[model samples]
Target: MGERRSTSQSLVSWTRLRPYAMISPAILVFCLFFIYPIGYMVYLSFHDWNFVSPTKEFIGTANFTYLLSNLEFREVIVNSFIYTFFTVFLTIGISLLLALWLNRGGAIYSFLQASIFSPHITSLVSVSMLWMWIMDADYGLLNWALNLIGIESIPWLTSPDYALTSLIMVAVWKGIGFNTLVFIAGLQSIPKDLYEAAELDHTPPWRRFLRITVPMLSPTLFFLTIIGIINSFQVFETINLMTEGGPINSTNTFVYYIYQYGFQFFKIGYASAAGVILLVILSVLTVIYFKVLSKKVHYR
Candidate 1:
C-alpha cells in the first residue's frame, strides 16, 4: 500500500510538470527575445557609449542626471502622463459603454462588435494616412463636411494647437475596439444568477450596474487600464508619421522622443537613459495600481 501511494504521488508530480515542460520552449523564447533585450537596454543605459563610438565609457549616473535636467525631457514626461491618463480613461470608459451595448445580445450586438473591432486589425500606418487625409483643411472630407455645416476648418495635423487632439482622437478610435472586446468578455463572465439575484432585490438597472457590474469587472478594467497606459506612453508610430513631432514638439511622446534621440540624432546613450527612466516609472505605477486596486476586484 505504501508503494502504491508513492507511485501515485510520483504520477501526480509528473502530470503537473508535463504541462510546464510543454511550455518550456515558449518560456525560453520570451527570455531570449523580451527579457534579454530589456536587460541589455538597462545595461546600456548607464554608459556614455554609442555602438559607433571607438570606446564605450561607463558614465555611471551621468546619463540619467543629464536627462533629468533637460527641460525637453521633462515636458515629454508630462506629455506622456497626460496622454496616458486621457487615452486610458477615454478608451476604457467608451469601450465599457460599447461593450454594454454589444452585450445586449442581438443582431445589432454582432454588427456593432464586428464594425468596432475591424479598425483594430487594420494597419496602423494606413489608419494614420486615412486620418491625415480626413483632417486636411482644403481638400479633406472632414473640412468639406464642416463647410456643409458652416463650421470653421480646424487645423488637425498642421497646427500645434490641434495636433495633440487629432492624435488622441486617432488613438481613441484605434484602441476602443480591443478594450470593448475585453469589456464584452468581462460582462459575459458575470453569472446570470447574480443579475437575477439583483432583480429579486429590486435593484434598479443603474444600481445593479454600479454595484454588481463594476465590482465584477474591476479586474478586467484594471488590466485594460494598465495596458492602455503602457501603450499610450509607448505611442510613436502615429505621431511620428503624422506630426513628425512638429509645431514645437506639441505631440512629442516619450517613445517618439526615445526614437528621435537614439536613431534620429544618434544619441544612443542618452536615449537609453530615457528608456530606463520610462521603465522604472511604468514598473512603479503598475505595482502601485495592482496593490491598491487588485484587492478591490470582485471575481463574481
Candidate 2:
C-alpha cells in the first residue's frame, strides 16, 4: 500500500495537481462573475441595442467612434483620469501617515484606528448621505463648524467648482481606514532587529524610516496603490447618490456614465462599449504597472 501510494504520488505529481485543483473553484467563480460578463459586454459593444428593443444591430466600431466624438464622453474620460489620480494619490499618502501614527501603539492609538476604520465598514450610501448633510453650506456640520471658527460657509456640493473636490474628500475619508490597516500590517511586519541595527549606527528617525521602513513596506504600498486606483476608477454609487453627476457633469465618472447610458437611458449597447473601453484601459494600465513595479516591490 505504501509503495502504491508512493508510485501514485510520483507518477501523478500530486503537488502540481493539488495546487491547481485547490484553486479551481475560485477560477470557476471568476469565469462566472468576471470573465463571462466582460466577454458579453465586449460582444455588445460593437452593436446598437436598446434594452427595451427586441433587436440588436451590428454597427462595428460605430459605438466607440460615437463615444469618442461625443464631447460629454470625452469630458467624462478626462474626469475619470483626474478623479482617479487625485483620489488614489491622496488616499495612499494620507493612509500611510495615519497608519504610521496609529502604529505608535499607545492608549489613544486603538481609538484613533477604530474611528478611522469605522467608515470602511459603514454603507457607502449611508456615508454619502452623512457627508451630504455635513457639506450643506447653510445647515451642514462642516460649514457650521467653520462659521464658529470665523471661516466662511462654502457651497460644497452645490458649486460645480467644489462638487468634485467635495466628493473626493468624502471618498478619501471613507477609504483611508482600510488602507491604513493594510499599511499598519506592513509597518508591524518590519523586524525590530532592523531598527536596532539602525540605532547602533545612529540613524535618524526620518532616515531609518526612509531607508528601512519604506523599502520594507513597498509590497503593501504597491498592493494598496493598485487597489486604490481600481476603487477610485469604479467610484460611481457615491457620486451618483451625493451629486448625481453634479452641476454640469463635473462628477460623472466612467462607471456612472456607463450606468446612466446602460440602465437609465436604455442605451445598453453604447454603455457596453464604454464598459469594454474601461476594461481595456484598466487591463493595460495594470499590466504596465505590474511589469514596471513588480521588480521594485520588496517582499520579505
Candidate 3:
C-alpha cells in the first residue's frame, strides 16, 4: 500500500513538471535575449569604456553623476517628458472622441475606420519623408494653404520652437488609429441594455455618456495610457529621420540621446548609463500609474 502511495505521489509530481518542461524553451529565450542583455547593460553602466576599447575601467557611478550634472542631459530629460505627455494625451483624447462618434455600425463608418487606420499600417520612414515634403517652408502644401488663408508660412521642422511640436503631431497621427480601434472594441463590449435602460429612463445623453460610457471605458483608457506613455518615452525614429534631434537639440529625446552617446560618440558605458536611467524612469512611472490612477480604472 505504501509503495502504491509513493508511486501515485511521483506521478503527480511529474504531471506538475510537464508544464514547466513545455515552457522551458521560452524561458531559455527570455533569459538569452532579455535577461542577459539587461544584466550586461547594468554591469556596463558602472564602467567607462569606448566600444573600440579593449579595457573597461571601473569608474563606479561617475557616468550617472555626469548625466545628472550635465545641462544638455537635463534638457534631454525635459524634452522626453514633454513629448511623452502631449503625445499620449492627444492620441488618447482624439482616439476616444473618434471612437465615440463612429461606434455605430455602417458602411461609411467602416470606410472611415479603414482610412484612419491606414496611416498606422504604413511605413514610418515613408510617412516621415512624405510629411517632410508637405511641411517644407518653401512652397510646400501646408505653406501654400496658409498663404491662401492669409497666414504666413510657419517653419514646422526648421525652427527650434516648432520642431518638437511637429514631431508630437506626427506621433499622435500615427498612433491614433490603433487606440481608436481599441476604444471601439471597448465600446462594443459594453452592454447595449444599459444604454437602452438609460434611454427608457429619459436620461440625458450627456449624463448617460458621462456615467455609463466613461465608467465602462475606464479599463481601455487606463491600458492605452500606460502603453502610450511607454511608447512616447521611446520616440526615436521620427526624431532621427526628420529632425535628427536638431534645431539645437530641441527634439533630442532620451532614446535619441542614447543613440548619440552609444553610436555617434562611441561612449558605450555612458550610453548604457543613460539606458539604465530610462529603464528606471519607465519602471517608476509604471508603478505610479498603477498605484495612483489604477484605482479609478473599471476592470470589467
Model number with the top TM-score: 3
Clashing pairs in 3: none
**104-134 per-residue lDDT for model 2 (tens digits):** 8777998889998999999999999999999
**Total backbone collisions for each predicted model:** 0, 0, 0
Model 3 lDDT tens row, 22-79: 9999999999999999999999999999998889999999999999999999999999
Quality of model 3 by C-alpha lDDT: 0.94
Model 1 ranges off by over 4 Å: 1-24
**Candidate 1 lDDT, 88-155, residue by residue in tens:** 89988899999998897788778889899988999999999999899897788888899899998888
Clashing pairs in 1: none
The CA root-mean-square deviation of candidate 3, after full C-alpha superposition on the true structure, stands at 1.4
lDDT of 2: 0.91
Where's the lowest-lDDT run of ten residues in candidate 2? 8-17
Candidate 3's C-alpha runs over 4 A off are 1-9
Over all chains combined, what TM-score does candidate 1 have? 0.89
TM-score of 2: 0.91
Could you tell me the lDDT of residue 159 within candidate 2?
90
RMSD to the hidden true structure, all candidates:
3.6, 3.2, 1.4
Clashes in candidate 3: how many? 0
